[model samples]
Target chain A: MRVPEVLLDVRDLRICYETSRGCVKAVDGVSLEVYAGETFCLVGETGCGKSTLALAIPRLLPPNARILSGSILFKGVDLLRVSDSKLQELRGKEIAMIFQNPMTSLNPVHRVGFQVAEVPVTHFKMSWREALATAVRQLGRVGIADPDLRSRDYPHTFSGGMKQRSMIAMMTTCKPSLLIADEPTTALDVTIQAQILKLLHELKNEYGLTLLLITHNFGIVAEVCDRVGVMYAGKIVEVADVTEVFEAPLHPYTKGLIDCVVARRKSKSRLNQIPGTPPSLLNPPTGCRFHPRCAYVTHECVKEEPRLIEVRKNHLVACHNYEKVGGVSWSS
Target chain B: MELLVVEDLRKYFEFKKGLFARKQYVRAVDGVSFSVERGTTLGVVGESGSGKTTLGLTILRLIEPTSGRILFNGSDVTRLSKEELKHFRRSTGIVFQDPYSSLNPRMRVKEILERPLKIHSDEGEESRVERIIKTLEEVGLSAEHLMRYPHELSGGQQQRVAIARAIILKPLLVVLDEPTSSLDVSVQAQILNLLLDLQSRHELTYVFITHDLLTAKHVSDFIMVMYLGKVVEYSTVREVFSNPRHPYTASLLSSIPIPDPKLRGRKRVSVVGEPPSPLNPPKGCRYHPRCPYAIDTCELREPELLEHDKKHFVACHRAGELSFREFLADMDSFLSE
Candidate 1:
């Protein structure tokens, strides 16, 4: 019944990557808000700029990626306008990120304990011994059995699930108020995936930490996320409560994506597939980026881009014909 | 008549230590047994290191098995001579998960498809070229793609080319190892539908290996759930999904995040921890360490795979102790949330 406090506000974010094939508009004119203590999910298929937007928040873009225009406001301060020194102070302290590939993100040459310890060691300027001790404790919290001994092992020796736990432990070393986990469980097995999801859910509630999860798996979205944002062609096409999105998807892209998964499926016939592959961000379609594959495309939809408008209470969609295309009735 | 049958196949790799140190053996595919009749698919589903991929490779004899027999059309492949093996392999094809890596970048799509024909068939230049063109068309690719290298094609197109290469030989059995995992869902749907159509038309038996339970259920006539190199449960797609007998299979099924938001709050058994180290898989039942319903006897003795229902086999010590309905109900409860 009440609007939650916005912890991170991304307004008019536009990011482009300088590639030899020309500039790619990776994150184009995106605006979003993450409220405090809510596990928000940004779900999309590959190459939809979900990762790009996540990296933009911490100004962790690669060398070729440039923030064309945007402001990432975190707790009333523009993360983009902040000085490098200020960002350094904020990163891994007030906000932490857990990447999809922990093996690459972690320093392989070092022990898992030492790598996780690096977070606290550098941020708090704690002694190596003190940090290592804290790392063991954090690893234990994330359910790494025998954390005391396992912490001494190399990350390469750890399984995918263990490596993920170590990454989660490392990310939370500073006890950040917000955590951004990007496809953390995508590479894991279903059983191991369930464990990781449970751990993440437990950690989110225990620490009262706001989470920004990026994944393409609708199952993971329903399992852990509270609010969901559907992404297509570097644009947010729909945003709603997780229940609202799955129960009644307003955007055609959102409807098509949910229809493709087998779990929530109703028909035994061929899946309701979206007609074409995702549009190339290098030269995206005019007006609505999803119009090329949209089932309810129209003259108005092709001429002008639509903005997020609330058709139902707290449910926002960016499609011109939400009423016509939102006829996606789920058995649930 | 069975198209392919694997009898208790075991493939192990020995890691040599120092002269004084003992050798360590990794049983990548241990005591796995299954069979598929003509025009049917046997889906092998498992998590990483569960040997699902290794099992696929072993069936194709890409890797030598440590023991057991691979019977193809009632003939033992393990006993085949090198020359006989070469000829025998012509009827079997395998499509890997990463299409980009599997396809040769140096060769054009034409050469890739032609090489198979050159090795297996004695068809002359004209017919070979014609076959190559036809194969490309069969996979929904036009002749225009013949000259292009793998790098020139998109992921979906490259995968189509890989599929084309696999079926170009007109193999009796095609092993699809996580074929659609790397592609997007829309592309995945197309590839799956194509595979299904091809299977029915060509009467090809498939060994579909993947970690996705949903896809396994959809594309398979029968399903085999493997964990740590051993089969935990094997049954018809409907039975395995609806009435899973093994705790591991039940846990695996429940773990798949049902895509409905309303089901989010539903009860689901959350497997507590990861599988133990393969080298030290728990003493008795491999799944006992993580099984929520694990009992004391489970830790002392392993459960043999038994027929719990018609054609449904499960390996769980408590299979008789606990009804699958109750086990499934308990599995549906979320431990953390």
Candidate 2:
């Protein structure tokens, strides 16, 4: 088998936020690699730092957040060392991100057409007329009927699904190699979510895009992701092929997360819940952040943090008792 | 015996564009009717703008219904006197979708749970504290949380506090409106399990309203599918899952991304286009514009909700004639392939 080229390589990235109480370690020494032309999903509960990691890839961390130590290599270029102009040149042209709420992301005062046209105009330096023309066609390409009329309307006139489509259209105007979608479909309805996800998959195929999808919903991961990384308390616990992640989850948190999704199977049995809440990032636990909630925690788990290690080819797990989690008796 | 019954409940809000402009009606809850058994849950499933929330609120008289009636234990809630309505409100409770907003951030957990008791009961301060502690324990919270404010608690704990407040009065029925939608998946499971445990222990009837079909199926005995302020399909959970008569229901079922990765490419019905504006909904079948199997009659004539099979109600022009079984079977075959 041919080895896939690495598109985005993140190494030992640590991110923290300055707060009144203390420094909140949002992403603590996490490392992962995304391959070209493949969908990599970072799945976790809220506040697990998946979104922060995604934002960190394109150097989009807010002012309050600081990168304690890390290197983000995109196409063999370390973004952290890049100059402001160089990073700005690479931002929307090569790396684009879509947030959870398109309503908030899109400017309410500007027409949808003008907002989309601004992308090509700013990045490629196209003329206003040419950019406007391109925007209409781009809107049509993203399944917006009558792009001419719809493009003239403001964000308020568009529905939630349409607003999302416009966001996708604007993001893909440059056809970036890497698209970081942070819970892109979390706000839409089920049917509309299906539509948006299908649109994303098609766009990925059309553009040969490498997708970094950050989501809490496993269903979306099952639908689109080629590989999966399960995050817990700002640390990655497991990374594996999508199929293996479901069929044979090595980490206890991964197992608990999969079992927690109320599956389609109609049964009265109770869902398997991870005991205790996630540790506050201000001052994490003594050792493993998940030891308090893990069902298979041992003395070793509490004393030291487990490192992500390759237990099998292309599959990794960070758990003291991963061997005990092998037997697949998944209720769902 | 039916514990709660809503008969043709309707809630319409009027919007006037100008002083002389005609007052247009936004039928938020056009007409919805359902009943719940004493110990069972009726899951009200729909997307946004489908009026499921309005229906829940109207049933509790939190949002007064413009028309129709709500009967609790054979007593008409709409006709109740001011004193009787106050008495009736104590037996019914509602937990909103967003716990962070539903809870008063200024109030501590003890005061939050105590507010309902102080208003509804004449118990002494000592007895109320005892009751508060017991109720907190029931929702898996402890005395430590009592003194903490809402912001100090996590999302799941805030929801548990909301649930505790809803049940502290020991109401016979509780309307859980998307209680777990805002929570993380693991925390969602914890809250769902807690709710089920509470229901069985207290014999409480729940009107569980949510947009998630999987959660609705998991917690509900009967499922009611809504679209544009109307019930498109209603049946026992088993019947709704196995033989969905309404095209919208079938589309909704097929649209859910089954968590199993193996079922990725399974056949599904993509209801083309989004739901039309509720202010000016489609003339005939509300779902006709998006229904894949929409026929000419579906656009010309509105269909009444009729019973197609024992205990299965569907509002569609071609409910019985359309073979959703064949469509669903095709999906099942592809899923198992």
* Candidate with best lDDT: 2
Q: Give the best candidate by DockQ.
A: 2
- How many clashes in each candidate? 6, 0
lDDT per residue for candidate 1 within A128-212, as digits (tens), equals 9999999999999998989999999998899888999999998887878889999998888888788888888988888889999
TM-score of chain A of 2: 0.98
Taking the tens digit of each residue's C-alpha lDDT, what string does model 1 give over B199-306? 988999999999998888768889999989899999987777777778788778778876766666655655768877777677888888888899898899988889
TM-score of each: 0.95, 0.98
lDDT of 2 by residue, A40-109 (tens): 9999988999989998888888999999998999999999889999999998889999999999999999
Which stretches in model 2 have alpha-carbon errors above 4 Å?
Answer: A264-266, B326-337
- Report the C-alpha displacement of residue A332, candidate 1, in angstroms: 9.0
- Best-fitting candidate, scored by TM-score: 2
Task: Give, for candidate 1 chain B, the lowest lDDT window spanning 10 residues.
Answer: B328-337
